[model samples]
Target: MRCQPERGHLVYIWTKNNQFCALCDEPSGVERDLCGPCEDELPWLHDQCSICALPLLVDGMACGECLQRPPAFTRVETPWRYDFPLDALVTRFKHQGKWPLGRLLADGLARHLLHAYGEGLPRPDCLLPVPLAKRRLRQRGFNQATLLARWLGAQLQLPVDEQLLRRTLETPPQQDLDAATRQRNLRKAFALSHQVELRGRHVALVDDVLTTGATTQSLARLLRKAGAARVDVYCLARTAKPGD
Candidate 1:
């Protein structure tokens, strides 16, 4: 049975089930690990760029950056804006080894994708999780993108090609970098596996978050170079333009 919180209460008590919200510790009122109130508080992205999915001032419009110079990916889809609690959740999932939180985020992303496809968004032939550098992989013990993609693939029944992409360079964290610097840092960072056959395929690159989009652009260019007909980006959230 489905349930929702009434109003303004942090501690929701549901006697029927023992599930608690991942974020609030309240009784879960939804199918997922999130309580209704906490889920509703997530920063959902509404008006966004058609190409990049960056939060925009108006709906159904591309941002000025995308209009000036289009990204390599054809389209981007994200369920949430990278802000507040969503950001905190992502940080915990990515850095703190919180697999359950990652699962919840991936579930939300999968639902969004399913709804988008139902609304006529073109589905891709395969999903590719952005590769992590060897050093980062060793340090983190897992690639968060791969974990998200695996969950999403199972939910969507799409093939996941985790081996198709490789990160050759170990770049510094992108958080402090400007757009131009991020792009340069990612140059030649991704290379396609020689064994993979991507010709004429539409592929979606999956990631935990999209900041300046430099990473996705680099990967999409590599995919296109490897003969992927179309490259799209799927991320959990899209950050608003830097300093916005």
Candidate 2:
């Protein structure tokens, strides 16, 4: 396969002083190789619901809703709770097509997850980026989630397989809808496509952020239906549910 450059993945980074990292605005500090402000503003999920990944009280298990009706995915791992510098960075990457920002965030997530799950989290056989609808892909030029997933997969030593699952609907962006409405909108939005590769394999589904989780859940539902043994989600950030 040959690599083809496109509009979506043409992201660069800006230094702390706004010198010249075009697509991204990353700070430069000695520690952790991140800007000082960037280091502090990064939200770590110290305690959270095990299943849904919402920050929660100590020793929290699964959120009530998840317990009542479990999500299609077994677990989610995200270091930052969608906020602050992360929010700005993520938004810039998604809407502005800053692909470098996506890569930086994905690297941070891969590191955090390796520690959080220890050896408990099984290494996925391959990575499946939550696909974008064809129209969106045409408009955006690149799938931000795909950009992050590819970089993250390389960092984690996992193969990236973009063809395993797909989005069927040009569903309204989840950020535009309420929780219930978001879930409703995403219903049946994904379908399984690759059979020979996905059957009985474990998959790590990647996305830029996990909001209402409708998108990730939808993908997981389809992958599992296609014979995947397990599905785990890895997003750069996760929004802590209301009242969490």
Question: Which candidate ranks first by TM-score, i.e. highest?
Answer: 1
- In the range 94-164, model 2's lDDT, one tens digit per residue, is 88886666766777888876776585777888888988989989998998878887888777888998876
Q: What C-alpha lDDT does candidate 1 achieve relative to the native structure?
A: 0.91
Quote each prediction's TM-score. Answer: 0.91, 0.83
Q: Highest lDDT: which candidate? A: 1
lDDT, candidate 1, 14-81, per-residue tens: 45456788888887865568988898999999999989998988989988999999888999999999
Q: Cα miss at 8, model 2 (Å)?
A: 36
